[model samples]
Target: MQFIDLKTQYARIEPELKVRIQAVLEHGQFILGPEVQELEARLAEFVGVRHCIGMSSGTDALLAAMMALEIGRGDEVITTPFTFIATAETIALLGARPVFVDIDPVTYNLDPAKIEAAITGRTRAILPVSLYGQCADMDAINAIAARHRLPVIEDAAQSFGASYRGRRSCALSRIGCTSFFPAKPLGAYGDAGACFTDDDALAQALREIRNHGQDRRYHHLRLGLNARLDTLQAAILLAKMEIFPEEVESRARIGARYTELFQARGALGTDVGGAPVLTPYVHPHNLSVYAQYTLQVEDREAVAAKLGEQGIPTAVHYPIPVSEQPVFHGGLLGADYPVSAAVARRVLSLPMHPYLDEATQERIVAAVAKAAGL
Candidate 1:
């Protein structure tokens, strides 16, 4: 079975996708086209935000948000080390330091309690990643940011359709960024992402930042990068967005089924143990899109190898903590973020998508159970 079943999704939306792309081609307004604006508006409305600035990629979206907040040159952005490198890379790219925080062992998201301890004089923003399509504790994180008067940027790359409490993931923070990478919950055909915020000034700043800091044509207001989203990608995303809510619901159903199946077998117990495979922990106030149906498995390498032998694809979302990566080696290794380190070793992502079939899922579960020697 395909890991994400993008082919099936494309088949389902083929007619609409073709129509959208045809319109973009017919218009011949590729750069900052009408479709781009339409997508931004629709996305903003979906996320309950006042503005959405589409960008070249998720990385650029994060960079644009940071630039808007003036988070650079000795500034520190607090985040978890369990996420993809882009979370910390964007901060370091701006000459700012990424203060690593340990994750909540269960959620694999930045621990809210540990965030305050990481803040220092240079702390400019708290960038919490909504890892594995589940939002981090935004309420607590926002409260801490409020106390410190710092901006919070939600790295909602994996959590576009996810919800925290009654609010959407991208609308929960000062500025939220999400990827349209093909693997994300809500994906475009190619590289694209958007930044969302209610603050008008920050919204304008982000727009300028995405267009080389230009307030208008030939008017350079600040140094920035060319991070405009392509018209084709925008059109494709607009089509995808039409069915995104349904897909999210489908994913949650699949996730719940997987939880039930695994929980039936003691092999998927929550606590760490000899035959335990821990299902992802979703916070009570949060709804996960299950971008990846990850589980904490002991002897992860062995389990993966065995699954591979059985023609069942399994992957580790992260094998090494970001703090231990070679890029950050010899620089920011002072703290012992035990939870991040521990989760990095055990976390394994199973094939998950809205279109994942029941037969395929059953086969996968059987393979994993056999691999765990259950």
Candidate 2:
């Protein structure tokens, strides 16, 4: 089976998608066209934010947010090391440091309790990644940021429809960034993303930053990158948005069902090679869009091989911690992040998508159970 099954999703939205693309082609306003503004407005409204700046990619979205905040040379940005490279790459690109923090073993998110100790005079921002479609402890993170008088940027690349304490992911922080990479819950045909905020000044700065720091046509204000989202991607996203709300609901439901199926076969706390198979944990009052329903299992390689033999595709969201990356040269590895290190070894992401069928899910779960020797 296809890992994400985007073909089915495309088939469902084909008619509307074609129409949207046709309209964009006819308008001939390819860059930052009317559809882009409409998309920005709709996305902002959905996130309950005052402004949404469409960007070239999720990486650029983070870069723009950092530029708007003036997080630059010699500054340090606190974040977890157990996420995608872009989460830390953006900080380093701005000539800043990415301070690594350990993750919560259960949720696999940056543990808020460990954040305060990482802050120092050089700390400029707290970038928390909402890994696996679930938001980090934003309430605690925000409170800590407020106490330190620092801005919080939610690297919401994996979470667009997720919610924490009744608020959306992009609206939970001072600046929020999300990706529209084809695999994301809401994605464009090509690379695209957005930065969201309620702060007018930051919003305006981000807008300028996305267009070579332009104040108006042909006017450059500050050193900025050309990070604007193309109109074709905007139109495609607008079309995808038509069914995004329902798709979000379907994903959550499918996630819950996966948990139930696993539990029935003795997943959690079930002995597999003298170790328990740990399922993902959703914090109370938090609603995840369930981008990747991952599990912590022993003998991950063996289990993955078996799953592959059964025609079930599995992936590891992150196999290496950013701290251990070659470029970091183990500079951030002085302190042991046992949880991040351990999770990296055991985590396996099963096929997950909003349109996943129950029968297919059952087959996939059964294969995993057999592989785990349950």
lDDT of the structure predicted as candidate 1: 0.90
Q: Candidate 2's residue-wise lDDT over 127-151, tens digit each?
A: 9999999999999999999999999
User: Cα lDDT of all candidates, in order?
Assistant: 0.90, 0.92
Model 2 stretches astray by more than 4 angstroms: 269-277
Per-prediction CA RMSD (Å):
1.8, 2.2
In TM-score terms, candidate 2 sits at 0.97
**Per-residue C-alpha lDDT of model 1 across residues 1-374, encoded as one tens digit per residue:** 67888998999889999999999999899999999999999999999999999999999999999999998889889998988999999999999999998987778888898999888999999999999999999999999999999999999999999999979989999999999999899888789999999999999999999999999999999999999999999999988988999998999899988887887776555553323338876767789999899987779999999989877888888988888888997876558888788778888899999988788888898888888776
TM-scores, all candidates, are 0.97, 0.97
